[model samples]
Target: MSTQPPSAPVAEPPPAGWEEARSRVYAVGLAAALPSTPRPLAEADGHTLAEPLTTRTDLPAFPTSSVDGWAVRGEQPWRVVGRVLAGSTPAPLTSDGTTVEIATGAMVPEGTTAIVRIEHSARDPEGLVTGVPRPRPEWRLPGEEARAGEELVASGTPVDPALIGLAASCGQDTLQVRRPPRAALLVFGDELLTSGPPADGRVRDSLGPSVPSWLRRYGCQVRAADVVGPVADTLPAHVAALRSALGTADLVCTTGGTMHGPVDHLHPALEALGADHVVNTVAVRPGFPMLLARVTSDDGRVRFVAGLPGNPQSAVVALVSLVAPLLAGLQGRQLPVLPQVTLAEPVPGRGDYTHLALVRLDRATGTAYPVRHVGSAMLRGLAGADGFAVIPPGTSGSVGDRVRVVPLPLLPGERTW
Candidate 1:
């Protein structure tokens, strides 16, 4: 079994409720880092743009046929004289009695006032229409969807594959986006180990592996994952180590040290380093002890540090609440959108605390129901959960109450329904 020092002290009990802790964290935080440079449009998914993208060409780029029909002259039906395909831009239509057979997406020659469907024309043995055409609107005008040089995408927009397609359609091959922040993760605990079967009194290190996934989800680059065992005992030394890590990192995350346990020296260490808590707690359950600290050395350099509870579920919650926001702010990106739904039952009571319950949101019915195995210590609740139902602070509603839910970080290679 892992051993604690004989002089190791006992920790203070966790604070009574969520609000006290959350307020502590928010009051002491800094923005997250933003991505830089234009990623090749090929790999820009999930990145936020740093600049607005203007269209180089109108959506159609020219007057185009919206249907496979005959482009005709003003007010009068005419005989088919020629054919126009999508790529060829023939000279403008000048004849009043003649029509050009045009395919869908083909450019309409000038002077054509309307399009007559091929079915409406009287076709001869020569594959040409020889009769008057039905009256209709002219070809679709250029710039109907987007004018040339109009803004096709705004800055700070998250770029997905579809957005990339839009950029390409607007004649752009690359896009400017905030750069992902670089992070250093420190997992601190006496009983933690990198790899090995857990002994009777020890647990395997979880945050080291789990946090990287969360970091990547927010477009962060985890540069180092250092598993620092509970060997740190003094405030000064812990602060120095964190400072060193911060020197090379945009953000630092420490797991298992936010609580006031006797051996939990992280809070004092942060104070010594000129760090103040932004939010010490949130009114959210399952993540009460989450702490956000903004550490700025005397000379004015700032670093963001997050302290997460040791429990796996608590740690994940803290990441979502504290780290995720910091990451988005640093990159100058907006927070992920939370999906909304109607709840199936009343959460036990109404209070100043926001309850985060593991839940399944049925896409088909727009109903949300709490999932099983949800205590802060239970990993199973997090595993099978699609997301969490966020009951706001101080609000109570019966079944069918409307609640918002922040989606869980999706796993890699998971198919999107």
Candidate 2:
């Protein structure tokens, strides 16, 4: 008979405002699915690991030569016995007075303790050399870098290129990683069209064109994006478009038609589809109207929908604050908090709002300066930005004050500043 008591259920709190609601949403959103199937090491870049990796074989499996030199026993003018090429397994290196010419990366002969460069040794027909009186241990011993069966990498680590090299050295031909989530972007606005030749007060559909690329950079497999007109009188078309997207996507991100007004029909549409609002608004400036919702399809599978501000800059900030972290979590990534940095200029008055200021880091001075343009609707400001400095709510900073800055997603080979 089982003696364990039934676990008591804790009381659940009601979702309050944005911060509390978002925290709850993230708790539920994080890596709900187990990581995806294992992939070959060749295809694992940009993927998150499903399981920890241990070394199968020692790095530099045997004592190997570190330089193009002569492998010898003790010091001194010695006779050349034989040569050991990189691939050939030489007979057990067992001579003290004799030397063997060993190429770089070749296995060090069994008995040779030190390696002397070929240039340092004089060759003669009789195979005797001088000036090489003492031999130093130049051999890179087996398992010196990493031993077999050691924990090479932890589970859920993003497969950075260096980790790939480590995996290869550990004899791993493949890795297990989370599957990239599939998503669709829908931009709703009658005044917007794709950029080209704009006519009659119409603006380009910025979110549709730009957001997908950003999503891809964060590891989302964005399948498609479309621009739908803002139909104030009837939002059925928009709702239908969203339903269609939900059919094939794990998430659907939309821009515009989110704020409170007669034309703001996204809220009602979401309610009609049985979606629950995780956050109706965020506290961050330039992204104050951002909203996130989680919905269950008719068959009970969950999906996420983020409603971003129509302005390009606001949309970008909202994505960074909400989407990036959420996606990273879902992909089994362990993202560290932004490292702190010092500001190069004073920002005194902007204290009421949580600010996300675009900034560039000075490589020479190790300082970060906020960029000039920070208007919510501005795109040019973001174009010149490398990363952002976060100013926490109710506090301002002076020129030399340090603040935390989050970096933009960098490509595999890019250097971090």
Give lDDT per model, in order: 0.72, 0.75
Residue-by-residue lDDT tens digits, candidate 2, 43-143? 88877887888889787799888788788776566778888999889876666777788899999888776788767667677667654523556678888
Tens-place lDDT digits, model 1, residues 1-417: 758668867665444354344333333332334437878988877677888988888976888887787887754446667889999986777877678889998988888767887776676676555545455564677788798889877776767777888899888888888766677777777777678888979888777877877888767777544434443555665777687778867788888778778778888888777787666656577777777778776766667888888888888888776776677677665555667888886665436667777778778888877878877767887888778777766776469888777677765334332
Highest-scoring model, lDDT: 2
Residue 168 C-alpha lDDT in model 1: 91
After superposition, the stretches of candidate 1 with alpha carbons farther than 4 Å from their true spots are 1-40, 67-69, 74-83, 101-103, 116-123, 130-139, 223-241, 297-301, 335-339, 350-352, 392-397, 411-417
Per-prediction backbone clash count: 29, 5
Best-matching candidate per TM-score = 2
Misplaced by over 4 Å in model 2 are: 1-26, 75-77, 129-136, 223-234, 298-300, 348-352, 415-417
Q: What's the lDDT of the predicted structure labeled candidate 2?
A: 0.75
